[model samples]
Target: MRKNPERRASLLDAAIEVLAREGMRGLTFRAVDTEAGVPGGTASNYFANRDALLTQIGHRFYERLEPNAALIAQAQEGPRDRAKVVALMHELVERVSSFRSGYLALIELRLEATRRPELRRLLTERIRADVDANIDFHLASGLPGDRTTVVQLVLSLNWLILERLTLPDVFPEEQVHDLVTDLVERALP
Candidate 1:
């Protein structure tokens, strides 16, 4: 395997696109190399095997999904009220809409994990860490929810919204907003 960070990142991004556009079956090293506009063997050089490539794609999805610093700062600086929470939820929805492809790839990763024990373990750990971090953030921000409530709310709402967003015509835009608002109101104090 080669050690080119930039190339590796580009190939992973290409992998995401391939996964999104064609699902798991289409995510081959040659496909990634073609998508990345690199040499035929470039992706194989960076990724030892399909499992390694898929794992990296899962990692890249989260890495690309780190919350925007400016948005986080804005949320932190402002009052931590229901309004702020609703706005944050809307922001999250907008983010999901914008990165529909990445989210689709993430969904594919989750399904693929179900049949692979190692990937399943890795994804489970990653998800738990994410939930823990979200819980901590909510507590630190003085959000009105217990850890369990927050965890359930975040996981449920996020997946619902993501599924709807990636698969168009599932829910109307206004309905999505209204549903999210209703959920937030109930989730928060």
Candidate 2:
């Protein structure tokens, strides 16, 4: 039988917790099953294999960010002399804080993926997609994209800085909004 959406989210939640508490070294189909209160092999049914499971976790990270992305798109689409990019970021910080337990698991996955080409591609794409979205936003903001090098540097900083932000997902949205926007505008041409 197909798992309900609630059950599926529960599985992912279990995977994140188990991976966080136990690290990649300890996560397994059985452990995820136990943590999620699903029967053994249930994880395998959804994830197919360990690699697939890890990959899904990475994908989930991006999915979690979609709300933030949508907000950014809307803000940019609206009228503003300044891009107000941080507005989007602040909204994202607020949204992510609730479902914020997955960062550690994702970081562990990145480390594990470094030695595994397949896994590396999964997380790498997540970063790339983030950058791509940022680039789209920057471009839509009417910024000059003449310097690819500078654009990349700023994009990298944005993602890494947000990643370092606390998870349970507490963050001062207003402070972060002001701080990040100042940093971006200062860095801009």
Candidate 3:
């Protein structure tokens, strides 16, 4: 196994692109290598098998989508009111939506997880932890509403992101910002 962290990261990122473009069935080592412009078998060296590749891609998806600390801090510094919650939600939508490939790949992983129990368990655990963290962050920030508010926002916002990425025609581009605002306004106290 190769110990080049940079190369491994690149292979994983390439795998993400393959997943986003070709879906789960297209995620092969050769496909990843071609996507990454690395020599054939490069991805195989980095990942043991299809499942290993999928699992690593799952982790990479979150790594690529992690929120910006500075943005979080700035949002937190503001008054912790309904408006603040709305702002945070807006930021969250913008951040997640910006990583189009990462989000799309995540959707693929989720679907694939249905048939693979290990993958399903991994996703379930990670998603639950993320939800819990969001709830905790919202409460500690003195944001309006409660756990339900956070959960509702998470659910609605994810669907919004899916619609935005997979079916832009479903909602006009300009309406997205307003929709996020409306979701927050309606979800929060």
Candidate number of the best lDDT? 3
Q: In model 1, where is the ten-residue run with the lowest total lDDT?
A: 165-174
Predictions in order: lDDT: 0.84, 0.67, 0.89
Task: Tell me which of candidates 2 and 3 scores higher on TM-score.
Answer: 3
- Tens digits of per-residue lDDT for model 1 on 27-107? 998999999999899999999999999898888888887798898788787677888878878887777667777888888
Model 2 stretches astray by more than 4 angstroms = 1-6, 68-73, 93-99, 141-178
Question: What is the lDDT, from 0 to 100, of the residue 96 in candidate 2?
Answer: 53
Using TM-score as the measure, the top candidate is: 3
Please report the TM-score between candidate 2 and the true structure. 0.72
Q: Give per-residue CA lDDT, model 2, range 94-180, as digits (tens).
A: 565445557667778878988889989878877777767666766667644434633644554446444545331444454555665
Worst ten-residue run, lDDT, model 3? Answer: 63-72
Q: How well is each residue in 1-189 modelled by candidate 3, as lDDT tens digits? A: 898989999999888888899988898999999999999989888888888888888888887777778977887796888888877788888888888998999999999999999899888988898999999988888878999989999999999999999999999799998999999988863
Candidate 1 wrongly placed segments (more than 4 Å): none
Residue 183 lDDT in candidate 3: 92
Residue 171 of model 2, lDDT score: 40
RMSD of each: 1.4, 4.3, 1.0
